[model samples]
Target: MTGKERLIELLKLLYAVTDEDHQLSTAEIVTHFAGQGVPTDRSTVKADIDVLNNCGIEILATKGTQIRYYFSDRQFELAELKLLVDAVESSKFITAKKSDVLVKKLMTLAGENSAKELERHLYTAGRIKPENESIFYAVDIIHRAINSERQIAFVYFEYATTKSFVPKHDGEPYIFSPYAMLYNEDKYYVLGYSEQHEKIVTFRVDRMKAPDILDKCIVPRPENFDPVNYTVNIFSMYDGEPYNVTLLCKNELMNYVIDRFGDDVRTEITDEEHFTATVEVSVSQTFFAWVFQFAGGIQITGPAIVKEQFRKMLEEAHN
Candidate 1:
């Protein structure tokens, strides 16, 4: 083989056998190069490693009874790759088949030996996976739209009487400004400015079909529009107008309150055993149901209209 060809084979050899966890000895690398029709000795291999390092490859050598070498810096460390694998396996937006494909691709970021260790930690069993496999493609298109400040068009689907999804609004196409992608409650949602409603809205990205970026410009997002606040106000992804509501809760439920509302929740101690918290929430049946789940341990205190609304909902349910 030509000298250039021999150098190329040596470089490939370093990548193949050397990684963060496993470093090949000089003799082992020589054996690999010999099988590739490019004979290399320890001295030539050492020179090749210098050439690679000069080229910014960062091949590191460790001294032992016998010196061994490995690539010191990789695009992703093994722990980072494992975190990515876990995200892929646990993502509800990705289908089971696609999750396997993604995990396999992520495993390539680690060395062969480290990949085996990563595989052992991946546990996707019993997780709910999306049936729609084209969600990833849709997400890519949406991201492009967002980057270019352009609108996107897609057909929205709704469940039909036949236990299947049918095009909604009589197959009418939806053109919206892609604002942000959100992963909440193990599901993926795209929050955007809907042209149909002329307001910011959220849609489950998995239910979108035939998504394409449009040449049209996107409507600019509103001033001081907080996506985090919008998500916190809504319950179970249900849509509603946000209301500043107050609730009196037992002191024992402090953890649940803080967990849901975070540390920013406004609280006032009410006589030792109870406290009152005022939070902005979407006043809906879903919010009432969540309160009801507390079994009288919580009570809506203010916004007479909301309290009346909750009372009527309970009265109607009792009937």
Candidate 2:
């Protein structure tokens, strides 16, 4: 067989063995490959193993068995596997039947034991409601636009409406260069550069419809454009000016804040019960809305204007 075909067969055998068990002896692997119509020898198998390991397949040799190889920790983590299943279940792009089929295929690759555990976790903790099919279609088009560096036009709605094609009150087409998709609260938001506004903007994926790709390519991303910091600073999916905001969070909320903000957070313990944290982010309606959700546990400590606004909102809500 051709060298490429031989390589494919060797890799397939490796995958099959790894899927069944985390470890396999070199003798086992060689025998397995030989059964698949490939001649296997110690030197040849050793070379193939080296090639696979260099290609990022984690194959570890155990102490007792010079021949045994096992997947490294990087191959799969229980948490990451669970998250993958969760993402698939929550995706709107694929139909239920299609998702089931895909999950089954993934399970085959992961092997039965891992597959069962993944299924258990998914069924217990994972819950997702299906979104409109059109949203999925639009998102697919937007992804293509982003990858191809093209502009896109789409109809977007701010609120729900039953009437179809109401020309005047319906939506207008908007053109933009797609930047990225942000997932928050189990919904997808698209960040893009708006041609009309000459600025960056975010649109809810569900509201977008009938996307058309344009010939124009995206301008180069700014030298300072950082996806992680940009998303965090915006506080929401929408792009805007950023501000450094300080918050007084009770110890109860310390873990929550750290989990949300990660190492980017600057924190100091004020007392046994309270901690002060600072986050550099945009002051947006969404930011305030999030603060409101953590009302009793978190208090805005700086940016007096935002603090006052938040106080007024609380007062108004109580009134």
Candidate with top TM-score is 1
TM-score quality measure for candidate 1: 0.91
Looking at model 1, the pairs that clash are none
Q: How accurate is candidate 2 locally (lDDT)?
A: 0.71
Worst 10 residues of 2 by lDDT: 120-129
Q: After superposition, how far is residue 25 of candidate 1 from its true place, in Å?
A: 1.5
Residue 100, model 2, lDDT: 74
Residue 258, candidate 1: how far off, in angstroms? 2.9
Candidate 2 local lDDT, 1-319, one digit each (tens):
7666776776665555454256677787778767877777788777877887888776667757366765543455657767777767666555566567667766655644466766733442445545345666777888888889888887776633875534222466887788888776667777877776777777777767688999988756777777667666673424444777898898988777877677668999899999999987677666777677886788888989878877887798789
Taken over the whole model, the C-alpha lDDT of each candidate is 0.83, 0.71
lDDT of 2 at 92: 56
